[model samples]
Structures are given as structure tokens and as C-alpha cells.
Target: MTLKLLVFIHLLLLIFMAVGCNAQHSPEDFDQVNLINSAGPYLGLVVPNSFELAPLLDPSTFIPSKNVSHIDLSGRRFHVGIIADQKVIVVMTGLAMTYGQGEDDELAWESNGDYTRDIGYIHFANYSTEESCDNLLNNVWFNPDEIFPKNGIPEVREHAFWVNVSETYYNLAEQLQNVTLESCINSTTCLPTTPKIVKVERGCSASILAANAAYKNLLHEKFNCTLIDMESAAVALVSLSMGKPFIIIRALSGLAFSNLASKNAVIALTKFFELLSDKPTNGIEMYDK
Candidate 1:
């Protein structure tokens, strides 16, 4: 071969070697098996809101003996609670928006010129309103006999039980309802009112998106975990599109599309943990079979 031709061939070989090296150094260089324990599946516990997981926030108060860890993504403060060799992460969602703020003047007007009485009354009113609404809704929508047939009643109740107990769900529902009611009331009061979006779009928050992204990134970075629970449907979509195994362990936080509270939330969480404990981690190994 001519000198020029030989030079060209050498350059092509160098290019090929460089491409091979780059490909070898790609993100997939990390092995999934090496990151997570080969003995069991890594559980991804996701609480919808911070309040739902308040009990588990302090590891010193309640420690689990199982091989599990917890992450708290409830507010601005992110905390990880590890128990029984498991990891738990805690995250904060920031200050939640509530109804109109009560001013000192308003308090004075409401209370007989007594700050203490005003505070007590306000507290009582808040609890009373919440209890009244909860009782009304629970009696109406949660009438097992009317809502579900005898055969399906047990299944429906089982699914909704957890959500019924969670405060997060109730708070969310109350907020949405408050917004809706205020809008409707304002529209009624104002003439020539403009058209407004009355329906609250469920599960559409930047915080939620950020939390899921951070979660997936952490899983990939730390445990090389590709298989994840299907709590966040949006996250599931992204994972599924990427050809990842997205297993969902939703414990039915509430009705098909309803708010959750104390009973409902706790039951869902407890059931999820129970299911995780009962299921065989190796039932369907990811990246293996």
C-alpha cells in the first residue's frame, strides 16, 4: 500500500478505538447486581404526602426490625430514616397552601375581645368543620352496601381502607374543595363573570415531578435499580418508555379518585409494607429474566 493509503488506514483504526472506548465508558458501565443486594428486591416506599409519613419521620421513636429503609419526601427538609438494615429517605414538599389566612382583627371580631377564647374557638371551629365534612362524605360515598355489592364490597373496602385513614388525603381534598367552593361562590356574587377551570387537575405538581425525578436518579445512581414501584404514574410512564421494569405497589390510598385521610392513608401504608414483606423479591428479577 502507498504511504498515503497506510496513513488513512491508521487514522481509521484510531477513530474506531476511540469510539469503542467511549462506548465502554457509558452509563451502563455500572452493573445493577453489584449495587443492590442479590439476596432480595429493593423496596421503593413512597408516601403521597409528608403528613402521611409523620410517624416514621423519627427513627428513634419507631424502628422496624425488617431489612428496610425509608425516605421522607414530605417537605423542604429531606431526611433518611434507616431501620433494620434498610434505607429510608425523607423529603419535604414545602409549605402547603391553605385557605385564607386569619388576621388578628378577624380573630378579635370572632372572639369576645379575648385572644385566648378566639384561638380556642378557631381551633374548635376548624376541627368541627373537618369532622362534619368527613362524617357527611364518609356516610354518603363510603356506604359499602350501597356503593359495592356483597361480593365486591370486601375488595373495595380493603382498597379504600388505607386512604380513609390518611390525613394527607383529607387535607388535599379539603383544599381542592375549598378552592372549588370559593370559586363558585365568587362567580355567583360577581356579575358578567368569566369562565374558569372548575375541576382540579389531580397529580400535577412540580414538586411531585421533581421528587420522582430525584427518586429515579437516586435509584439508578445508588442501587442501579431499574425496577420501581408504580406510585407515581408519571414516573412509571418515563421508566416504561425507557424500557425499564415499573412494578406498582399501590395500596389504594383512597377511592378510585377521591381524597384520603387518617384511616385511609395509614391502612394503605401498612398494607403496602405487608405486601412487600410477603412477596418474594426474586419472583421476577430485573435485567436477569
Candidate 2:
């Protein structure tokens, strides 16, 4: 073969090798890098993707994903501001439906949902509060909410669900003393306001019903938490394992077990981000009693 022909053959071989390497990269191969971590204090903002989370981000910079949901591609994931400086990474901990459809495990998941999909998010699930919250609904065949007698008082009132929002953040309230959210673009009536600081021992994020009387009371008595959501616990879990400073703040737009207006959800998330940019209140500590 001529010299030119041989050079072309070598170029093709190089291209093939590059393509092969790229294609071989599975989700597990990239897990460590993509999972959130910081050498100093970092914030992991977990929310369900809804009108609730949208207005909190900068205008249009954090729009919904146009890409399909892929386990490794992170089509549903995105960032705001500078990661190094702001230390903020917004996480959309998908709802009950999203978990069943996307993940591949059944351990923590309770549902008409099955765990047969990509468990690329396992690191997050595995990391929520130490001890893995294994006893969250301990000794119950059905979910605690399912099996707990409709009228029966909880048997496990002192159960500690767990939290990983680091001790550093517990006293970081001084940093947020002067901040406020002045407005919300996506909301007409959600209205901008200040965020509150609370030392919520255990935060649970799930369906609206989970925030109701029997279930809500159980969390309050067992874990000493009064707020509810499906996102916080899981986020706290991941933060603990990663050794990042984390906290979950929520607002009560509507009473739990009552009609939760969309605006209420939006308002709660609004305060969450505002709190993210600042620290909790100083002097007045969130009490355990």
C-alpha cells in the first residue's frame, strides 16, 4: 500500500479505539465524580421538580430538561451559580413514580413501584442519615403508614429516623440574618418572603398524605420531626455519607392533611432556596421541645 493509504488506515484505527473507550463507560464508572462532595462546606438542595422548585433558581438558567431520562446522562440534573463558590447543587429527588421507574432496588422503596431500573442514584439512597434508617418502619411487613392501625397510637414514638445535616450547619444561622427573597417570577401569589431556621431532627419528604395526622404524628413522636417531604431524608442520607454540610428547611403553605394548594408548595420551595443562599437565624435556636 502507498504511504497515504497506510496513514489513513492508522487514523481510522485511532478513531475506532476512541469510540470504543467512550462507549464502554457505564454509569458506575462515573458515579464517584458526579456525586456531590466538597472539601469545605457544601449545600445539597433536594426538591421534587414542580412549580415548587422552579422560581427559586435564576431566571431561565435552570429550566426543565429537554433530554430524556437516562441513568448516567443526568438529563434531569443541572446546576446553578458556581459550584466551587456557592457550593450549591440542586437535586430533583423524583416522586414515588419517578423512583419506581428509574431505580433498580426495592430496599428503601415502598410502592406499587418495583425496583428494576437503573440504580445509578443508589449512592444518594445509601448515604441518607447514618444507620441507613433501617428501622424507619421497623418490624412491619407493610409500610408503617400502611400497617399502623388506623386509630392506633404509634408503638415506636422514640424511634430516631436519623439526620446528616452536619453540626457545622447547626450553628451557621448567623450567616442568614439579613437575607430575603424579594420576589418570585413563576408565581403570581406565592409571594417572596424570608426563610425560617429550625433544627428539625428528622425530615420526611413524600406524598402529601404522608404529612397527615397519623403519619405526621408518628414522625413527630418517633423522630422528633414535624415537617414532611420525600426529598429531605434521602438528601440528608447522601450528605452524611459524602461528609458535606447539609440542612433541610421547609415552609408550611397549607396545613398538612388539608388541601395543599399548588401555590403552597411553590412558596415552601421558594423559602428553601432563599435559606440556601443565607444561614439560619442567630440567637433564637430552633428548639427540640
- The 0-to-1 C-alpha lDDT of every candidate, in the order given, reads 0.28, 0.37
Cα TM-score per model: 0.28, 0.44
Give the alpha carbon lDDT tens digit for every residue of 1-289 in model 1. 0000000000001111123333443332223212223323333344444444564444443354243232111112323234334333333322221112235423211233222332332232343356445332232122211133233435453221111112222222332222211112233343233222122122211221222344446545654544333234433332222233322222221111112232233333343344434433333222311
User: Per-residue lDDT of 118-229 in model 2, one digit per residue for the tens?
Assistant: 4444333454456656533334232322222223466533222454344444445344444343333345634345433334445554443252355457667765665666
Candidate 1: segments with Cα more than 4 A from true spot = 1-41, 56-231, 241-263, 283-289
lDDT of 2 at 110: 41
Give per-residue lDDT, candidate 1, residue 127: 37
TM-score winner = 2
Query: By summed lDDT, which 10 consecutive residues of candidate 2 come out lowest?
Result: 1-10
